[model samples]
Target: MKKVILTALMSCIFQFSNAQNDIRIGGMLAYGTEVENIGIGVNAEFPIIEKLTVSPSFIYYLPKKVSGVSINWFEFNGNANYYFLDEGNINVYGQAGLNYTNVRLSYDGAYSGFLSSAASDGRLGLNLGGGANFQMGGNILPFAELKYVIIDEGQLVLAAGVKFNL
Candidate 1:
């Protein structure tokens, strides 16, 4: 299942490369309580239709000690964003999508344990969020976003980044 999803995502990126009206690539700093850590991410926004865009993002959280366990986390998401105000320097948008998250845990200097087993499982979740885009002169846009992840235990994410139009 993971392989298929990854293949499809890669295909979409290549297929849309030439046809997309606008493409923005950027990096973000993310914080979420589920991982109880800060993460770094890269994202690309591709226009799909009028006032609508598709964004693919990946985030990696550094290993951190939490509750006596060391944890490392990562996530991949594909989101659809609808711009409420598309024709201005400032745009507010709503986004909804799906994400796949993977976590690894270590305890007592060993990786084989209940926490490791549970954390190694892949989780699929829903992502809902909103953000604002501040377009600077030319092709630079700085953005801030907030998103919620609905899974076993819900998580809230806050991210900020710069988008470069291509």
Candidate 2:
């Protein structure tokens, strides 16, 4: 079941790649409250129409200690962003999205206890921030954004990365 879904998703992504013009791929470093640790992510932006873009991103949070267990967390997000300022080489946008979060817990002690446990949850969030695209006469744009996520809890994320246009 998972393989089928993954294959279908890959197929759709390839099709979208072939049909899009303003596609950007980038990586980011993130930190938040619930995450409890620094995270890393990669994202791709596909322009659906003028001033509108759909971005899919994946983030993996570093393992952190909670109680007596080590927890690993990650999330997948799909966001729809609308650009209100798309003039020249700089663009500013507001984003809203849905996220699927997963967490894995494990205990490290003399006695192996609860060897495996995982939990997954989904949430809808909004990113109320804008970023500047600095086009240095190339296909790469350096951008920085500060966004707050409103979900089960509020989290502030600051991300800086270079986007490759394809």
Candidate 3:
């Protein structure tokens, strides 16, 4: 089941990247509760049309320790965004996409089998968000975004980074 899902996601990523005017690479640094610590995410967007873009991203969170248990996670998401206003250095847009979350765990110090617990799981996520692009120079712009993902407990991510128009 997991293999099938991952395979499908990989297929979509390749197909999307090969498709129109988009920012090729971008990333963000942020702090959040749901992430349990500091996190970083980077994404690449391929424009499918004038107003539509396809984005694939990867996010990683720092490990959090609790009761001798440490946990960390990373996920890959493929998203679509529509730019309502793509003018000057300011661009406002709405986005949505399918996200695949792969959660992993690592134990620092050991204990009983039941006491030291770890598991690998995956989930399907939905993303809804918006952002602003501030032109920094000619082909480079710094941007800030607020994104929310619907998963088990709902994850909210606030990120800012530089995007290069391609």
The best candidate in terms of TM-score? 1
Q: What does the lDDT come to for candidate 2? A: 0.76
**Model 2 agreement with the true structure over 136-162: per-residue lDDT tens digits:** 767887877766767677677777788
Better model by lDDT, 1 or 2? 1
Better of 2 and 3 by lDDT: 3
Tens-place lDDT per residue, model 1, 21-140, is 478899999998888789999999988765788999999987887767778899999999999976578899999999999987766634445433334678999999999999788888
Q: Write candidate 3's Cα lDDT for 109-134 as tens digits.
A: 44555545578888999988987778
- Error (Å) of candidate 2 at residue 87 is 5.0
Q: Which candidate is the best by lDDT?
A: 1
TM-score of each: 0.79, 0.73, 0.77
User: 130, model 1: CA deviation in Å?
Assistant: 0.7
What lDDT does the true structure give each of the candidates?
0.86, 0.76, 0.77
